[model samples]
Target chain A: MELLLFNIFNGFIIGIFYALMALGLSMILGLNGIINFSHGGFLALGAYMAYSLAPAIGFWGALIVSPFLAGFVGLIVERVLIRPLYGRDPLFSLLLTFGLAMIMQDLIRTFWGATGLPFEVPNALTHPLSQVYFFITGYRVFLVALALLATASLFALLKFTRVGIRIRAGNADLEMVSALGINIYRLRAVNFSLGIFMAGLAGVLAAGRLGLTPTMGASLIMPSFVAIIVGGVGSLVGSLLGGIIIGVAAGITTTYYPAASDVVIYLIMAVVLIVRPRGLMGQEGLLE
Target chain B: MKSAASRHVDAAKPADAMSSQKSTRRRVAASALVWALLLTAPYWLPLTGGYTDLGSRVLVFSLAALGLNLLLGFTGGLSFGHAAYFGLGAYGTGLMLKFVTHSTPLALLAGVALGGLGATLFGPVTVRRRGIYFAMITIAIGQMFYFVAVRWNSLTGGEDGLTGFERTNIHFGHAILNLHNSTIFYYFTLFFFAIGCAVVWSVLRSPLGHTFVAIRENQKRLRFLGVSVGFYLWIAFAISGFIAALAGALYALLNNFTSPEDLNWVLSGDFVIICVLGGMRTFWGPLVGSVIYVVVQDYLSSITVNWMSFIGAIFVLAVLFFPWGLLGFFQRRIQK
Candidate 1:
């Protein structure tokens, strides 16, 4: 029972990571109409930046700042490389980002080397809370709490902020929003950075748990894509729910047959595609 | 008794006929030039400081990209997961030679069947989605195969990849064809490549091919016209999948090794880039794209460790400047 509980908790944490990732990806897919393949690259960039900044600013300071740094870089990239490709076939943007991902990964490898770097977790968060549940480390609990906090803050911002409302409106109908005289270009740029910010934060947290490697984010990107597909496009909450469902399912499968864990999530996606083709919350014909 | 419309057409017919005849001549000359160069590559390549194996590698990639172009360029489906079928073909051939049989022909057939069947079975699910969703679903689907290859250690040889498979020499009664020779292997690959080109060419000429183009041109219009767009897309997917598998089978034979990388999304991206880089809309675009890509990759990886950066830059530059590709650009210029 303890083992099962441990796996479930672990899965939940992993699911949260996927949800954070899917949320960022979903935002871009919803508003920008481009699948940011380099989101993974941005993720590793965030973690690496955090790693480099930690000694200068301390762990707490670096964690808060690095994601913002990654976001700033994303804003520039969006302005230069991604902005022109808008209103074109999605293929061009997809290929362009795919190339950008390669460049980012290669640059990361060039600077940091290919070896994995261990992130320094704070001592206060390393210890287990109790003897009964030895698996429940303070770091793990902190990760879950912080993820929840971030997600809640995002929801609140979207609900209350002026920019947030505009982003939402843009997602539903871009032409109408533009016709209303809103600067959709500037809105897209902001939304793109916002999505990258989520990836950066996920990276910082993921590095603490999984360690920093140039290729680490590559594997995670696919599952997040599956999460979006299963959750249904154009739905943020659905993405969150989908991520947890697959993560927990994989976690449970890991107990009996470890080899089958990876394939099981794909099975769920296949099932979802068959039963609900439009996804869980996808609006009809909302290609935007 | 001739109508006024017929008389008008008759007056303009001579000029139109001359232009059409000239175009036909130009096309035939271009085809002859390409064939002549390909046929003489073995002799000329050595003179240009190249190896026979490089020629085979180019053909393999060309075949893969060509197959992908059928769906991506002609059928207008952005399938980002095609590497799954390509990898499946390599795995199928490698497994057959490793455990099932020793004959190269049978192994090739088995590999093609395995990869092609996987695509056919999965086509329904993939074809159900269009545009971005289609691209996302395909990538997810490829990852499934990639994980299976990684985890099935006992059968697939795990991350180390499947090995111990050798391409056996064939027997033709009294005369023996030496498969171990690089030149012979190049010819073997070229033979298959020719078959692939012929298949694609003939298909493009057929009514089904026209329908595929129609679907790409206007899906909603075709739907309103009572055509099953999904069904036609599925057919394109399966055929392209078959061609990708054939390329993979040839690739396995070229190296005598197969790995999880064969089925990776990175390679899928490469295939798509090859199509785009060469000119997706052009019939010979895949071939032209594969040549530039494979050669540049070979040359770059030899000199610099930062070869991927250069390759990535190629992808960016290609998309930004020449979205139509080299062939497409030239074709446009000539027309103007």
Candidate 2:
């Protein structure tokens, strides 16, 4: 029972990071009709940025600055590479994003070398929260709370703000939104940058918990994809739910069946695809 | 007899004479040139010493790319799990050669059969979805197989892979073809490549191939036309898998080893690159793409370790400037 609670707690903690990553990907896909395969690279960049800047600004300031930097990079990528391919075949975007990912990965490797970078947990969060029935790490609890706060704030902004309404309108019908004299292209640019910023935020948070490495993005990227798939593409709530489910399942499987843990998420995806091809909360015509 | 033949010829002349004779002549000359190049390449290539092996590797990659072209280029389904089938073939041949008496024919057969079996089982489920969903499901399945290969230590030798296998005899009945000769192996690969290309060419010209084209153009419209889109997709998927496995088995025989990297997503991506680089819609695109890719990889890696960055840049450039691929661009130029 103690082990179960521990796994659940750990799962929720990891799940929040997954949610942040998937939320970015979902928004990009929903608004731009592109999968943004390079989103993982942004995550890696954010982690490295935080790793380099954390010592000077401290963890809190690094978190604020790293995502903004990532968002700036994303805006440049959108303007230069992705914007032209908006009306062309979707595969072009996938290919371009994949190329961008390769470039980012190599850039990280050139700068950071091939070794994983060590990151110290903040002094306050390093202390244990409790040691009673089940031991809980203070840092993990803090991560979970921070993730929740960020998500809630984003959700509230999207639900209530005029800018959020414009973003939503643009996502639904780019042509119609443009017909209404809205700067649809500029809106897409903002959406893409915002999405990348979320990915950067997730990356920095993840670096604090898991350490930073150039190849770390590869590991997280697939899981984020799986989370989005399971949660239903284009739905933020679905991404959160899917991430938590996969995170817990992965944690439990690692504890129980070590050999299958690496593939458990994939197995779950296959089963889900066989049963519900559109995912749990995915709407029809999303892929089309 | 001469007068009757002349009358028949004269009757057929109107339609034949109206067609562009120059285009026909150009096609015939080009085909002859290609055949001559292929026939003489093995002999001419070995004169350079180190190039023989590279040439052979290109041939193997070409065969694999040809298989991928059928699914991606012709059928419009982008699969990210082709390496699973390729690995299945390689491992099948490796394990058989390790355990049993080394017979190349048997190893090849076993590889194709196992690969076909895998495709037959999984193709239906994978072909049910389209676009990103299809790509995701295939990736999941591929990863699942990768996990099995890693965990099943008894059969797969875990992460170490099936290694140290010796090249055996190319036995036909009681006749043993020597396996040690590089020239002989080159000929063997050429023979298989020629047959594979022929099969692909025939399929492209058949009614079923037209159905595949229709399916790619619009699945809904094809479905409305009463064609079982799923059934056609399954056929393409299975055939492509079988061909990939055949190439994998040949690779094992050529190298005398197999590794887990054979089934990695990178290998799958390589196949996709080959298809796109050559021209996905053309019959010979994958073959051209594979040849160029393998050669560039070999030459560039020898020059510098940062070849991946170069390859990535090339991929981006290809998407941006030459989306129709090399073949498509050349064909359009020729038309002009």
Worst 10 residues of 2 chain A by lDDT: A128-137
Model 1: lDDT of residue B117: 92
For candidate 2, write residues A150-248 as lDDT tens digits.
888878877789778888877677789899998888988998998999989888888988888887776677677788888877677888888888888
TM-score of 2: 0.92
Worst 10 residues of 1 chain A by lDDT: A279-288
Candidate with the greatest lDDT versus the true structure: 1
Summing lDDT over every window of 10 consecutive residues in candidate 1 chain B, give the lowest-scoring window.
B1-10
On DockQ, the candidate that comes out on top is: 1
Shift in Å, residue B154, candidate 2: 4.0
**lDDT (Cα, tens digit) per residue for candidate 2, span B1-336:** 112112212111224443457655765786677667767777787675446666667778888888877987777777877888888888888888888757778888888788768977899888987776677667667767877888878888888888868777666789877877777787787788888788887887799887876677677888898989989999999988988888888888888878887887668777888888988777768877887799888878889767778887877888889877887677666654
> What is the per-residue lDDT of model 1 for residues A1-288, given as tens digits with 9 covering 90 to 100?
888888888888889888989999999988899999999999999999999999999889988999899999999999999998887788888899999999999999999999999999899999999899998999989988888988898888877998899999988888999999999999999999998999999999999998999997787888999999999988999889888888998889888789999999999999999999877766677662
The CAPRI quality class of candidate 2 comes to: acceptable
* Chain A TM-score for each of the predictions: 0.98, 0.96
Q: Estimate each model's TM-score.
A: 0.96, 0.92
True contacts kept of 2: 0.38
